[model samples]
Target: MTAPEDAIRARRRLTNKLIAGREAQRLRPFFAADARLIPGGGGLILGADAIVDAFAQQFHAPGFVAYVRTPETVEVDAAGETAAETGRWTGNGQSGAYMAAWRKAAGQWIIESELFVTLA
Candidate 1:
C-alpha cells in the first residue's frame, strides 16, 4: 500500500474505534467540512455536521450497535490526493458493502463522501 492508502486505512480504523466508543463528536476531524453520506438504508446526509449529528442519533438509539467497516480495497488516484475505499460493514445484525471517497487536505486524510448498501 502507498502512503496515502496507509493513511486512509489508519483513519478508517480510528473512525471505527470512535463509533464503537460512541464518541460521535470526535468524528468531526475524520471528515471534510462538506462531507456527504448515504446510509445503508438509502438516504442522503450532507455536510460533516449533519453526518455527525446522524451518527450521534444512531449511537444513542435503543438497541443500536456500532458499525465496523473492513476495507477490501483502497485505490488512490494518480495525484495521491484522493482515494476510494470499498469495504464490508456490519452492525446491529446487518451486514453490507460500503464505499468511501477520501481526500487529503492540509496534510490530513478525511472522508469526502460515502455510500452504503445493505445486502443482508
Candidate 2:
C-alpha cells in the first residue's frame, strides 16, 4: 500500500479502537511491548500495559468522548515501516494535541511512542 493509504488505515485503526473504548485490547494488537506514552503534565509511562492502563483511566471518565480530527497528516518513512501522526483531539471537556510514532510489526502498524499535550 502507498504511504498515504497506510497512514489513513493506521489512523482509522487507532480512532476506531479509542471510540469503542478498547484501549487495552487495542494495545494488544497495535502497540509495541515497550511502547511509551507522555501525557501533558504527567510523567512518562513506559510499556504497553502501563500505557493502556493510563488511557483506561480516561476511558472510564464520565461522558468522555474521543474525537480525532479528520485528514490528520501522517508522514511515512521511506522504508514504509514507520509513520507519524499528529493532530488535535478533544474529550472530557478538554482539547489537546498529540503525536504518535508507529512502527510496522509483523506486517501491522503498531504504536511505538506517543506524546500528548493538553490545550485547555
Candidate 3:
C-alpha cells in the first residue's frame, strides 16, 4: 500500500487499540518522541511520555471507548513525508472530532501531533 494508505490503516488500528485500552501496544510504537497532544478541554501536552501518561489517566475513566466514525479521511502532502487524519470520534459518552498529524521516516509513519476537539 502507499504511504498515505498505510497511514490511514495505521490510524484505524490505533483507534481500535485505544478503544480496547491497549496503551502499551498502541502508543509506544506509533508516537514520535517529541509528539504533541491537544486533547479537548485539556490544554497542550508535549512529548510522547507526557502524552502517554495523560492517556493512561484518561483510560481510567468509565466507559471510555475511543473510536472514529465513517467519512474519515487522510491527506498526504505532495512530498509524501507528512499526512493528516481527520475524522469524528466518540468515547465516554461524548463525540468529537480529531486531527492527527503524522510523519513518515524509514518507511514508517508515526504520529507527530494530535488534536481532539469535543463537539458534544
Candidate 4:
C-alpha cells in the first residue's frame, strides 16, 4: 500500500482525469458520504451526492473546461486517520488555491471537505 500522502495524490490525479473525461458519476467514490465543499465561485455544497451533482452541472455547462488540481503539499496527522491537502486548481478560465480534508475510512482515503479560493 502506498503512503497516505501518495494515496491522496493519486486520488487527486484520478479526480482530475474524471473531470476531464466528464465522468462525474464516477467521482462519488472519492468523497465521503457526508462530504462538504466550498466552491471557488462562493457557495457551500453539502453532502457527497450534492457535490457530485454540482460537478455534473459544471461538466455539462456550455464551454465548460475541466478542472485540474495539483497538490503542493499533503500532511497526514499523527494518528494517520486524517490528512490535509493544499493545492492549486485551474478550470473554466479561473485559477485558485484549494484545500481539502481527507479521512481514511476502511483503509481507503476519501475527501471529507474542500475549500477553494479564486486567486486570479
lDDT of each: 0.95, 0.71, 0.75, 0.96
Clashing pairs for model 4 are none
Clash pairs for candidate 2: none
Superposed model 1: Cα runs more than 4 Å off: none
lDDT of 4 by residue, 14-68 (tens): 9999999999899999999999999998989999999999999988899999999
What's model 2's TM-score? 0.78
Q: Candidate 3 has what TM-score?
A: 0.82
- lDDT for residue 28 in candidate 3, whole number 0-100: 65
lDDT of 1 by residue, 1-120 (tens): 449888889899999999999999999999899999999999899999999999999999999999999999999999999999999999989999999999989989999999999999
On TM-score, the stronger of 3 and 4 is 4
The whole-model C-alpha lDDT of candidate 2 against the native structure comes to 0.71
The positional error of residue 27 in candidate 4, measured at the CA in angstroms, is 0.2
Where in model 3 is the C-alpha error above 4 Å?
1-3, 67-71
Per-residue lDDT of 2-94 in model 2, one digit per residue for the tens? Answer: 555465565566666565664655645566899988876668999988877866776787776764544366888898888888877665667
Query: Where is the poorest 10-residue window by lDDT in model 3?
Result: 62-71
Whole-model lDDT, candidate 1?
Answer: 0.95
- Put down candidate 3 lDDT per residue, 1-120, tens digits, no spaces: 566766566656765666466464366657889999888776999998887787677777776565554327888899988887888877667778888888887878888988888899
Q: Per-residue error at 28 for model 4, in Å?
A: 0.3
Could you arrange the candidates by TM-score from highest to lowest?
A: 4, 1, 3, 2
